[model samples]
Target chain A: MRKNNLKGWLYLLPAMLFLGAFMVYPLIDVFVYSFEEGYNFASQTYFDIGFYNFSYVLHDTYFLQALKNTFLMVVITVPVSTGIALLISVGLSAVKPLRNLFQTIYFLPYVTNTLAVGLVFMILFKKTAYSDGLVNLLIHWFGGASVDFIEGPYWAKMFVMCFYIIWVVMPFKILLLTSAIASVDRNYYNAARVDGTSAFRIFRKITLPMISPTIFYLVITGFIGAFKEYSDAVALFGTDLNAAGMNTIVGYVYDMLYGDSGGYPSYASAAAIILFVIVLTITCINLLISRKLTRGFS
Target chain B: MNTSSQTNYEQISKTSARQKRAVHVLVYTGLALWAVMVLFPFYWMLLTSVKSYSAYNGERFPRFYTLSPTLQNYADAFTTVPLGRYLLNTLIFTAATTALMMLVIILAAFAFARLKFKGRNAVFTLFLSLMMIPNELVVITNFATITNLSLRNTFTGLILPSVTSVFYIYLLKENFAQVPDTLYYAAKVDGTSDLKYLFKVMAPICKPTLVTIGILKIIECWNAYVWPRLITDDENYYLVSNGIQEIRENGFGRENIPAMMAAVVVISVPLLALFLLFRDKIMTGVSRSGTKG
Candidate 1:
């Protein structure tokens, strides 16, 4: 028994070491660094300012904008993408022909690098004052004034970001919800059909209730993902978050840590911890709210 | 009475057929619209990449298709910067990260799944909770740690922090637990060491999940953008993601949209092809991960 314990520990040693040094240590370091004010990276030293760092971050206008942007992304993208994905998956489940092909097609964005796809979107939405770009071309056809999506005002940039997120996230949710829908028994549909129920009623009353678990899953995971939105910002708006005034929570942290010619690790670390707390709190609330829904079926 | 019932049945069947046809139209229309939305960007990428500089900047609104096409942008993309080298670095980083990540995950997952050691549940729960902590939270200190170790601008710096994913460990643990405990004991009774049995028995049984993890990890590493950008400052260490972003940053000032699109096209094609080829594995793996989580 002792020998077995020793062997098991030995097997876990490498991974444990890696996690300890990287994850656990950094986690603690970030917490500590969050409290250190004016911790000059060059000098490798700092004085602890108690809760002042947190207060500073809380009062900072840019940080508040980032927090609001983060919330905006989560609030808008989650429901929009999840609802669209649910619709798409339902439509997909109804069609028998070329279903796999369609699923694969839908999944293209999920596999493609976000930065690459975001770049593609950047090109699609690039400034075309003459309505030359693809999006602008569409805008022109509708007699809508051309707006420079990437370089436009804050709302335009956020609009572009939300659209990009929906495009990227819709695929995975579609895939997930499709399988969840597929797992529902076909007999329920047959019963509903025999009762002369309308198709819309069948979907709302039967199909949706059956797939609520998956819907809940998507919402929870979607919120988590939206909270961590990063690379797309970098890809869409370039590295200058201040120029765009569209800094996301993670993007704000990232720019703080890396954007400056000199480092602002302390502020960045504090912002990161704040972001982490917000995510954790929201996720816990999600779990709590979803408990009643998920508990119904399973 | 029989004639009336038959007439009613025929009427019902005919209406049902019409309804079915309507449903088909709805399904196809919705699917087609979404397919167009999904594919439009790629089409846009290709279209923009092939447009000639004169046409791109000429006194005409850009349309979907170009009457004349040129490969000049692709040529310029290769020539303008070290895109080729960046792609190579990305490939190296992805492969190394995947392999090393898999090794770490398999070991840790197996230990968590089958071993009856002390603190097993506690340790497993700890790892599971670790997944809740967003990676961005830790990246700052990780950057400091990497810089401290003088691993900056190296593949190690990029790979080390991300080597062991808590999520993958949880996934493979779930997969590993599904293997019958009897087999593990049977192997043990037959004098197989735990490591030997892990490789010979558990790993083989979990091949599909392993492949799933491997594929997902590859895609993760491939799509990784932020960390690699943070760690590497040298042109030599740039991955395809940050490299393309950097190219876009530098390119557009010269009105090099075509070249940037060409670079985007080149970087995107391989994954698109991979998805086409391994559609089932990728889909199954992804859905499996989702459901299991």
Candidate 2:
């Protein structure tokens, strides 16, 4: 038995090696490269301790916009999607025959390739002076003027962007919350019923608390996922071949590396390192906070 | 709990039947509306994909069966985009990466679940916390790593960074914990190696979870766009999603939107079909993942 147990450890070694080569190695290299003066793809010469790389990214206007946009995206998306999905999922708990079917429908968007979804939106949203898309079609139905959704930073752009993310995200949340809502003992509901408590009250006191842990779980992950998304920027917004300044932080990193490095991408690497630190730090904080909040239940 | 709840719940249920009926109606209405919103875009994409240029330019929605619908867009899509190459690349990437991730997750999950080593909770917590870090930073550093490794345009480079799925480990580890240490003891008694026991015993018990994670990894790998685009500058290395973008970029002027949509529809259909085929497993996988989301 001991021999076999050791064998299991050995089997796991190959995977560990791959992780070391790919994940651990690169992660360390990011720091090393970031601290270096400059890296030329042509020569691969990395020399100098230019904190200037980090300083430049820190001072860049577009980088700040990307950071702002990315943060706003996470803050707005996580709670909103989780809250709405929780509502829909709670509603779904009592309905059996329709539950799985509807849940599947909601989850469809989540599973679909975001690339196609983004492209589809671009075509659907295409509105010039004379043309109309789906939203415009609806507005016309209401006897209203057609509006270009992606152009102006009106309620329309925010609305479309939010709507797109919410659609993609809601399914995952609904599916997750459905299980959490189901986890609550039916006895609690019965007890409340025996006490003549209203359905809403039972939900507030029992259902909400029971599902708080799951809610926290979705929020942090959702924030991370939504924040990193640059598909909409690249696919839906502009035509720089890589969707230029609708730049999310990740998009900005991409722009720096692939777009115009001027033969030296060390600055982008520095920016990337800072981003890694930020994400690592923020994620750790989020986990600690979630743990603290749901210590008892989790 | 069931007995008392059954009695109290029955009383409340009997009294609230009418109210619950109203609630049911409202709930269904809300769900139906949401379902439409969630569902309509995909439907619209399909509908628009099939609509001919005349119909697309002319009508809001196709009304009759008499109108000519051609697979021309599908044809143009395939021809216009290196969709064949993209699909092949995506399939290969997803399959390879999924295989790799599943192997790592199953093993690491076992280690986390069964092995008694230091930093167990702390390490698990680190991986779980890794969940909260958006891919933005990782991807940027990943690009830098790729450039350094000189793996800039390779398949392995594309697949390497993404194969580390922390959440999958959490789910599998949680499932693995439920296997009752009795099994591990039995395996030990039989003198099976830890690796063999994992594959031979724990892996079988965790099969459902494994399958679920496998499907997810495949779907996720297939859907990968941002990193692939960043890492690979050429269309030769493009995955299906980014390839679609390449198609759009190169064929922008002459290709009609419907035809382009036809290309998208083609790109997406296989995955959608896969989703339908494994709908139950996928839902449960997603649901279970969500339980701790």
* Best model number under DockQ: 1
Considering every candidate listed, which one attains the maximal lDDT?
A: 1
Question: lDDT per residue, candidate 1, B174-201, as tens digits?
Answer: 9999999999889989999888999999
Write one digit per residue (lDDT tens) for candidate 2, span B1-293.
Answer: 56966676677778888888888898999889998887777787777777777777775533423256667678777776677888889889988888888888888888888887544577567567656544554555567667778898899889888776777778888999999999899989999977788898888887888888888777778787777877887888889878877777776463378887887787788888989899989888777665222
> Candidate 2, residues A1-298: lDDT per residue as tens digits?
6754565465446555655655555566666667777666777776678687898889988888778767776777787888889889988997777877897788788667776887778766667543567777778778987777777544566566666777777878888788889889987876678888877888878898888887877876786677666776666664352233456776777777676543446666676777767766777898898788776544
Quote the positional error of residue B107 for candidate 2 in Å: 5.2
Docking quality tier of model 2:
acceptable
Off by over 4 Å in 1: A128-131, A293-298, B1-14, B291-293
DockQ of 2: 0.42
Distance from true location, Cα of B52 in model 2, Å: 1.1
Off by over 4 Å in 2: A1-9, A153-155, A238-244, A260-264, A276-298, B1-12, B59-66, B103-135, B148-150, B163-202, B252-255, B290-293
Candidate 1's displacement at residue B256, Å, is 1.0
